[model samples]
Target: MKIVISDYKSSLNFDINYAISYLRDTLGTNTEIIVYEYNGNNKEFIDILNDADALITGYLEIDKEIIQSLNHLKIISIMATGFNFIDIQQASRSHIGVAVNQEYCTQEVSEHVMSLLLALNRKLKHYTNDVDAKGIFDYGTTNNLIRLDGSTLGIFGLGKIGRSVAKKAQSFGIKVIAYDPFISEEVANECNVELLPIDDVLSESDNISINMLLTNENVGFFNMEKFKKMSKRPYIINVSRGALINEDDLVDALDKELIKGAGLDVLVSESPNLDNHPLVNRDNVIITPHSAFYSETSILECQRIACDNVINYVNGNYDKMFRLINPEILK
Candidate 1:
C-alpha cells in the first residue's frame, strides 16, 4: 500500500517523521510512504497523489475535480476538527473515507477564548497602547470596565469546546448562557448553562463567544442585524470560524460602537491582505493568526490521531478510525 502526506510542513509546521515510522512499522517496511509538501502548484502534487492509496493532510484543499481524479485514494485523514477545507461530499461520491481529529485541541481553544474575552473586557489593548505607544499610564484613560464575576457570557454553539468554555467561565463566577439548536435544554442545564434563543443570548450577554461550526447556510450570518440585537453592547469573542461574521459589518459595528469590542482568532480569509485589511491593528479588535489550536502536546496528539485513522483504515480495522466524516463510504 502507498500513502501520501501533504501540506503538513508549510501549513502546520508539523513533522511527519513519526507517522512515516509508525506506518512502516505497522504496515511493514515494504509499505510505500511518500511525503509531498504542497507548494501552491496543484499539477505538481496532483501527480504525486495520483499513485497513493491514502492521503493525510493538514490544510490542503482537495476540491471536486481533484477528488474525482484521485482514483487510487481510499481515505483522507485530516489533522484538525474542521473539514470545511476539503470537499467531503465529493470524496463520499468517490468512495473515499474522510476522518478528523475532533478533540485534540479542545483545551487549547477554550483557554484561548477565555484569554481573549478577559483581555477585551479589561481593555488590555487600549491601556497597553496608552502606556507603550504614548508613554502615558492613567487608570482614568478608559472607562466602563466591568467585573467578570457578575457578568453573563453567552456562547453561540455549545459543542465540545463551547462546553469547556462554559465550565471555565463558571469558575470565574460568570453566568453561562448558550444558543445551540442541536443541544437540548436538559443538556444545557446539566452543564449549568442557561439555554436561550440567539437574539436573547445577544441582548442579555455582557460578552458573547461564538463557537459555531462553519457551514454553507450560516456563513456571514452574524452581520449588522445581529450586532444591533446586542442590547448590552457585548464584547464579541470568536475562536471559531472567521467567515461566520461579515468583516465589513463587524467594522461598521465597531465604528458605530454598537458592540464594545471584538476578539477574533480566525478571519474570513486566512491569508488576508494586511495592507488594507479592515480588522488588523484596530484598537477594539484583537486578531490572532488562527493559532488558538496550537500547543506542543496538541500538535503531537493531532499528528498521532490523524496517522492512526489512516493506519487503521489501511489495515482493514475500520472500527478504529478516529472520527469518520463520511462513514457511508465504507458501506
Candidate 2:
C-alpha cells in the first residue's frame, strides 16, 4: 500500500518527525510512505497523488479534478478539525473517504482563545510595543482595560472548543452565553450556559468569541450590521475559520468604533497580502496567522488520529475510525 503526506508549512512552528515516526511504526515495513512539503504547483500536486492509496493533507485544497485523478486513493485524512478544503461531495462520489482530527487540539485552541482574551483585555501587546520601540514608559495612554469579572462572554458556537472556552472563561469570572442552532437547551444547561438567539448574543455580549464551523450559510456572517448590534462595543475574538467575518466590514467597525477590538487567529486568505492588510500594525487588533490549533503535543496527537483513521480504514477496521467525514464512501 502507498501513503502520501503533503502540505507542510514551516511557519506552523512544529516539526512532523513525531507524526512520521508514528506512521512508520503503525504501517510497518511493507507499506510505502512518502511525505511532501507542498510547493504551489497544481500539476505537481496531482502528480504526487496519482498513485496514492491514502493521503494526509495539511492546508491544500482537494477539489473535484484532483479527487477524480486520485484513482487508487481510499482515504484522505486532514490534520485539522475543519475539512472545508476538501470537496466532500466530490470525494464521496469518487468513493474516497475523508477523515479529520477533531478532538486532538480542543485544549490547545481553548487555551489560545483565553490567551488572546487576556492579552487583548490587559493591553499586553500595546504596552510591549510602546515600551520596546518608542522607549516610552507611559501606560496611561491606552486605558480601555475592563475587569473580566461580572462581564458577559458570548460564544457563537457551542462545539467542543466553545464549551471548553466557556468552562475556562468561568474561572476568570465571565458569565457565558452561547448561540448554536443545532445544540439543544439541555446541552447548553449542561454546559452551564444560557443558549440565546444569534442576534441576542450579538447585542448583549461584553466580549464575543467565535467557535463555529465555516460553512456556506455563515461565510462573512459578521458584517457591519452585526457589529452595529453590539451594544457593549465588545472585543471580538475569532479562533475559528477566517471566512466567518468580513474583513473589510471588521476594519470599518474598528474605524467607526462599533466594536472595541479584535483578536483574530485566522484570516480569509492564509497568505494575505500584508502590504495592504488592514489589521496589521494596529494597536487594537491582534492577529496570530491561524495558529490557534498548534502546540508540540497537540500536533502529534492530531496527526496520529488523522493517520490512524486511514490505517484503520485500510485494515478493514472501519469501526475504529472515529472522525470519518464521508463514511458512506467506505461501503
Candidate 3:
C-alpha cells in the first residue's frame, strides 16, 4: 500500500519517522510512505498523489480540483480539528474518505483560551511591555484591568473545549453563559453553564470567547452589526477559527471604543502584512500565530492519532475509531 504524508508548512516538527515506522509495522513491509514538506499547491504533489492510497495533510487546502486529480486515493486525513480547508462535499462526491484529528488539542486550546482571557483581564500584556520597554513602574496607568471574579464569560460554542473553558472559568468565580444551537439547554446545564441566545450572550458578557468551529454559516459572523450589539464593551478572545470574526469590523469596534480589546490565536490569514494590519502594534490586542493547539505532548498525540486513523481505516476497522467526514464512503 502507498501512503503519502503531506507535511505542509508544519512548525510542530512532527515525528514523521515514528509514524512511518508505526504504519509499516501495522500494515506490512510492502507499505510505501512518502513524506512531503511542501504544500499541496504544486504540480509535484499532484504527480505524487496520483497513486496514493492514503494522504495525511497539515494546513493544506484540498479542493475539488485536487480531489478529481487523485487516481487511487482512499483517504485524506487532516492533522487538525478544523477540516474547512478541505472541500468535504467535493470529497464526498468523489467517494474519497476524509478524517480529522478531532480529539487532539482540546486541553491545549482550552488552556490557551484561559491564558488569553486572564492576560486580557489582568492587563498582563500592557504592564509587561510597559516595564520592559517604556521603563514605567506604575500599574495605575493600566487601571482599566478588571477582576475575573463575579464577572461574566460568554462562550460562543459549547463543545468539548468550551465545556473545559467553562469549568475553568467557574473555578475562578466567573459566571459562564454559552450559545450553541446544536447543544441542548440540558447539556449546557450539565456543564454548569447557562444557555443563552447569541444576542443575550453578547450583551451580558464581560468577556466573550469564541470556541466554535468555522463553517460557511459563521464566516465573518462577528461583523459591525454583531460588534454593535455588545452592550458591555466585552473583551473578545478567539481561540477558534479567525474568519469567524471580521477583522475590519473588529478594528472599527476597537477604534470606536465599542469593545474593550481582543485576543486572537488564529487570523483570517496566517501570515498577514504586519505593517498594515490593525490588530498588531495595539496595546489592547494580543495575537498568537494560530498556535493555540501547540504543546510538546499535543503535537505528538495529534501526529499519532491522525496516522492511526488512516492506519485503522485501511486495516478494515473503519467503524471503531476516527472522526469520518463522509461515512457513506465506508459503505
- Candidate 1 has what TM-score? 0.95
The regions of model 1 sitting more than 4 angstroms off are 8-10
Worst 10 residues of 1 by lDDT: 7-16
- Two-way lDDT contest, 1 vs 3, winner: 1
lDDT by residue for model 3 over 123-240, one digit each (tens)?
A: 8889889999999989788667688899999999999999999989999999999899999988998988999888999999999999999999899989999999999999999998
The residue-by-residue lDDT of candidate 2 on 1-331, one tens digit each, is 7888887464334666766777778888667778777767778888988888998886678899888888889899888888888999999999999988868889989999999999889988899999998898998979978999999999999999999999999999899998999999999999799999888998889899999999888999999989989999999999989999999999999999999899999999766778968899988889997789888788778788888888888888988887888778756
Using TM-score as the measure, which candidate wins? 2
Candidate 2 vs. truth: CA RMSD? 1.4
Residue-by-residue lDDT tens digits, candidate 1, 1-331? 8988888344646666878888888888998988877777888888998889999887678999899999889999998888888998999999999999978999999999999999998899999999999998898988998999989999999999999999999999999999999999988999999999888998999999999988888999899999999999999998888889998999999999999999999888765677878877887889987889998898788888988998888778988877999888777
**Residue 125 lDDT in model 2?**
87
Q: Each model's TM-score?
A: 0.95, 0.96, 0.95
In candidate 2, which residue ranges exceed 4 Å CA deviation? 11-13
Instruction: Tell me the whole-model lDDT of each prediction, alpha carbons only.
Output: 0.89, 0.88, 0.87
Best by lDDT: 1
Candidate order, TM-score descending: 2, 3, 1
TM-score pick, better of 1 and 2: 2
